[model samples]
Target: MRELLTALLSQDPTIEVVGSATDPYQARQMIKQLLPDVITLDIEMPRMDGLSFLEKIMTLRPMPVVMVSSLTQQGAEATLNALELGAVDFFPKPKLDMKRGIEKRADELIHKIKTAAQAKVKTLEREQDTPLALNPLSNIKFSTTEKIIAIGASTGGVEALRVVIKNLPANSPAVLVTQHMPEKFTKTFAERLNKISAVSISEAKHGERVLPGHVYIAPGGKHLKLHRSGANYLCQLTDEEAVSGHKPSVDVLFRSTSEAAGKNAIGVILTGMGKDGAAGMLELREVGAKTFGQDEASCVVYGMPKAAYDIGAVEHQVSLNKITEAMLNACGAAKDRHIRV
Candidate 1:
């Protein structure tokens, strides 16, 4: 596996193939000696598990680290944990035919590596095991069910969305999220977030009514769009061709929210690589929906938000920690009081 990754990475002249390690201990030594710009850590390792090692790295010496994970349920969970521990990004390991699968996704791996190098990596502090509570937003009453929140993210979105969703009050408006992830990973992602969040969160099913106090994550292989079923909002899933180079495209969701909810919607573009949600966010903003973008300092990769901000799509540019508060405030669910997380 190391040989294959090295060979594959070596093919790209822009990326140098640094020293590879067979285990975490070796990798630690190599990291101190070589001090590479980016390191890709396999989830499964011999001496120590990737998550533990990743935690150590993030706490001790923060740097860009991309996790190479398997496609299994366990792998999905571990990858999400690694992200929470402050790893820059993750890519699933090729399941059946290793060589063929890796070769097929060669371009994607290269892109992730390049992006990881430029990512904003922060030192990770130990997180609380309990669910977070935001008192300022919790006390505000949301009278209407018409209000909706649409969010789009990729790259570092796992951790970004986790922070945003966990901080939301239980009575917050319905949230529709489009995060770039594989088919197998999205279920685990939603389930993990559901466990820690105040609001109910799950992968969106076709034709399901979008409800207040719930978060609907776009299923990985399908695009989640907003539709009006009479007075109620419904989640509409389509297996349409990839837009902006992604399935469950953020543009599709934001545009649909623009058409359906218009002024009643709040659009948030989070940390990611690429311009998927920029145009759709523009559409939402033009239609009077409030739009927010994660600022560059808070992003792991500022590509998507930067693109949106550049095109005048984002109305509010804030840090990641403040996004949930901003969204709730825009929805008229936050009081003047502030509670620091």
Candidate 2:
């Protein structure tokens, strides 16, 4: 597997293949010597587990790390944990036909590695066992069920979305999220978020009625869109062709929100590595919906938000910590609470 990965990565002229290690101990020594821009760590290792080594790396060195994980339930959970622990991104390891699968996804692996190299790595702080306290906005009673929050993210989205969602109040407006993830991973991601967040979160199902206090994540291989069914909103899932090189493209979600919810929707473009949501955000803004972008300083990779901001699609630029409050304030759900940009 290491040989295949090394050979594949070496094919890319832009990516330099550094020394490969047989275990985390060897990898540690190599890292100290080579000081590579990015490290791709496998989730499972012989001596020290990838997650444990990842924690140590984030704590001591704090360099961007991309996890190579298996496409399984355990892998999904572990990959999400790595993301929470400050890993930049994750790539699913091939399960069957290793050589063929790896070769087929060679481009994707290279892209992830390159993106990780540019990510703004951060130290991993110890997480509390308890869920975060509900945002102060929870005290305010939202008046209407008409508002919808549409969020688009990729690359660093797992952690970014967690930070934004965990702070939202239980009574917050319905949230529709389009995050780039694989099939099984989205379900695990939603379940993990549900455990920590005040709001109910699940992978969106086709035709499910979108409700307040709930978050609908776009199913891994499907696109999630908001549609008006009579007077109430419904979650619409489609297996349409990939838009913006992503199935659950943020562009598809935001464009649908623009058409279906218009001024009643709030669009947020978070950290990512592409321009998927920029045009859709512009569409939302043109229709009078409030739009927000995660500022570069707070983003691990400021690609999507930067693209949106550059095109004037974002009405307000906000940090990751304040995104939830800003969205709630825009929805007019937080009475008397003003978001200080």
Candidate 3:
């Protein structure tokens, strides 16, 4: 194990394997002695389970952590819990054949580690500064017409989506999301999102009726389209080829919503990598939809929104803190909350 880890470090000039251990006791001692930039943990380590050790480490000395997990039910659950507990990400495989998994995915693991090492990890306890107003819409009168809100994101989207969706009123029009993530993670993510928000959120189902006051999440590994059904718009999820290098591409969602929902749809492109949603956002703009992008200052990485802005797809640029209110304004609420004049 140490040999493989050493090889991985040597291959990457930027990474230095400070220290590693075969058990949680040794791991703790190594951490105390080395204080490495990042830790790649094996979930099945001896002495103490990786998840429990991770919980302890995060509670005692919060730092960037990435877990190596198997593609089994237990591994997935553990990884999800670790993520919720402040671990940045997990690399998964179905086998314990270390040579094949480690060598074949060394580059990917290297990238993940580099990103994790630079991440600003905030423990759950440190995030309680501003409580989200549980009923922010108590005093505002919303419009009667049905509306649909379309949101696009990638990279650091999970946490961002939570902040925006949990604040949306139960009466807010149908919301659709296109976030760049793998197939497995999206289901878990949707389930997690549903638990925190007042509005109902679910993974998008093919041929499902998209109703007002419900949020439809685009399933990962597929494209989601919106079609008009008499005065209503319904969702259609498909296993189509990847568009813009992503199956559930933001451009695909934005374009479909533009053709079907037109002026009734609101398009928002949040923090992400690459230029996936730029052209589609322009299409939405041509069809008279309000479009927004998270400003560079608040973005973990500013690639996606920057591309959209460069192509004139985004009409307004706001920080992560202001997006939920902006969506409400796009829905014809009193414009004083999420948007600035």
* TM-scores, each model vs. reference: 0.95, 0.96, 0.81
Model 1 residue 333 lDDT score: 56
List clashing residue pairs in candidate 2.
none
Candidate 2 residue-wise lDDT, 131-192, digit = tens: 44635656767767799999999999998999899878888899999999999999999999
Ranking by lDDT: 2, 1, 3
- Compared with the true structure, the alpha-carbon lDDT of candidate 3 equals 0.80
Q: Which model scores highest in TM-score?
A: 2
When 2 and 3 are scored with lDDT, the better candidate is 2
The per-model lDDT (C-alpha) reads: 0.91, 0.92, 0.80
**Model 1 residue pairs with clashes:** none
Best candidate, lDDT = 2
The TM-score obtained by model 1 is 0.95
Q: 68-111 in candidate 3: lDDT tens per residue?
A: 87766566667767776767666775467768777887876787
Candidate RMSDs in Å, in order, are 3.7, 3.2, 4.6
Question: Would you list the rank order by TM-score, best first?
Answer: 2, 1, 3
Report the Cα lDDT for residue 246, model 3: 86
- Model 2 TM-score is 0.96
